[model samples]
Target: MSQTTARSAPSKSDIAVVPPRRPSPWRDRLSRLDVKASPYLYIAPFFLVFGVVGLFPLLYTGYVSLFDWELGDDNPVFIGFDNYVELFGDDQFYKTLTNTVSIFLLSSGPQIVIAVLLAALLNARLRMPTAWRVGVLLPYAASLVAIGIIFANLFGPNYGLVNSVFELLGLDRVDWQANRFASHIAIAIMVNWRWTGYNALIILAAMKAIPREIYEAAWVDGASPMRRFFSITLPLLRPTLIFVVVTSTIGGLQIFTEPKLFDAMPGSNNGGSTNQFQTVTLYMYQTAFEGQHFGYASATAWVLFLVILVIASLNFLLTRRLVR
Candidate 1:
């Protein structure tokens, strides 16, 4: 009884156990950003260069389109809407516009189809798959200027290989540069020849990403190769196909190199002797540099730019819907 120790009274602090605090949402977000910092830094240079060179030029062009900007002159004459007005009244503008659209249709339609077919072939179990892949991209490595010149000779008015073949087959030698339809077709051939393999490679890459399991499953269901391509591959490849289409359209609109060189004399600046193969881009070039009407060319650029925007939007919308 005498040895009883004094005991401390029960205090809330002694009895209670404190729990650890959870991190704030802001801190968590900051940590996540820290983890992703490397990737963002890696891609920063591309965005920076693109913004500086690509975007800046595009924006500057828009601004210049609003004024009369003459080459070799620092003083930009502020003439609002005059250039646009003149472009509408110009007959050559309409002709080139129609020509551009026609060539785009002719080139892009067959290009996509042939690319898909080629991609399918490339995807097949064949010897030297790697070699075939490399070979397909060979045209891409060749000089576009050389391609244009060679094609020009092939479709020449007389003594060209194409005409010689036609003569052997009892057909008349079609003057490619002289007629509108023939000229467009010739340019389209050039376009297809140069770009089809590249497009095939693009679609092939997309096709490779598709799961073999899906294809095997389709095969197990007795689906033929063509059926599987149409049902499974095509559906999965829609997004990639859309990307290809949009990019092709953009490149198609800038169809200067092939058509410009398609002339009898390379670098004539005029599309052809009669301007039969003149595309919108060729017209823009002639107007800006040859005719020295920088302001009008800018206006033409803006018109085509708007048309591209509209067509791209429509393509995206239509593709999305069709895929669904």
Candidate 2:
């Protein structure tokens, strides 16, 4: 019996027949948690930063808008909607709104048209293409304040380059800041100059992403360049066009430095002699800094934000319709 037990128990194969050890519960739980929560842990930083910096300040700004707060005043009077009511009643606000909309339309409309054309031109196979693209983006990279200063000199009534050119051609020198309309034109010119190339570059990137087979198919069908652009390129590029339009609208509505500097000459207080070029943003700045009405300025900012939101929503809806 002892010999039989030794033969059954002492064999290495018999010893190796023990069941495989089970994994520890703690290690299994840790592995499961790592698999489930690793993604969330990676993305948590974005939410935390946005909550702290973006959402909190936006909520605070909204709360601050419903008050009678001055820059130097110690007490902020709780005046619900009074600032908004006063804003509505103020002629300056209406004027600023009109100018903002006008400039946005004027600049964005032509910018879209010109940008589409330039983008088409750039989409063609060309030598030194990257250099050309960089050249186009130069103005956008330049400082807005510097652009404003340069344009101010260019649009000067006397001894300005624009006036000099007009005189050389025996044409009348335009009084660029004499009225609201002319000031709007000047601001539009500056905006268009600065943004057109940037928009064109964006559209060009979109155009390049389109499959070459579509263009080749159109070409085989004897489609002209313009026909291909209208039927194929524009349709495919609709989403990019909408993006450019919305961004342009936002920038144009918030135009400040160009108009402000243009009107910074003698006898031009709140953006030109007639306040024609004063955008809502410019007005907000003047209200906060010059008029010392901080609450009113905040209200103006909120109104401007709403205007941008509405316009952007409309653009998005239009884009959806076009896409369909």
How close is every model to the real structure, measured as TM-score? 0.86, 0.87
Q: Give lDDT tens digits, candidate 1, residues 1-324.
A: 212321345445533432246456798798888888978888999999999998998887777777888787688898888899988999999989998999999999899999999999999999999999989889888999899889999999887899999999999889887888999999999999989999999999999999999999989999998899889988898999899889998888879999888888756877887778899989999988988778889899989999999887887888777764
Deviation in angstroms for 137 in model 2? 0.6
lDDT of 2 by residue, 1-324 (tens): 646766766776544554367456798899899999998999999988998998887777677789888988898999999999999899999998999899888888898899989988888888999999998899999998889889988988877899999999999988887866777888899989999999999999999999999999999999999888889998899888888878877777788877887885643348776787888998999888888888899899999999999998887788667754
Superposition error at 16 for model 2 (Å): 20
Predicted structure 2: lDDT? 0.86
Of the candidates shown, which would achieve the greatest TM-score relative to the real structure? 2
Residue 28 alpha-carbon offset, candidate 1, angstroms? 14
State in Å the error of residue 278, model 2.
0.7
Query: TM-score for model 1?
Result: 0.86
How much lDDT does each candidate structure score?
Answer: 0.88, 0.86
Clash pairs detected, candidate 1: none
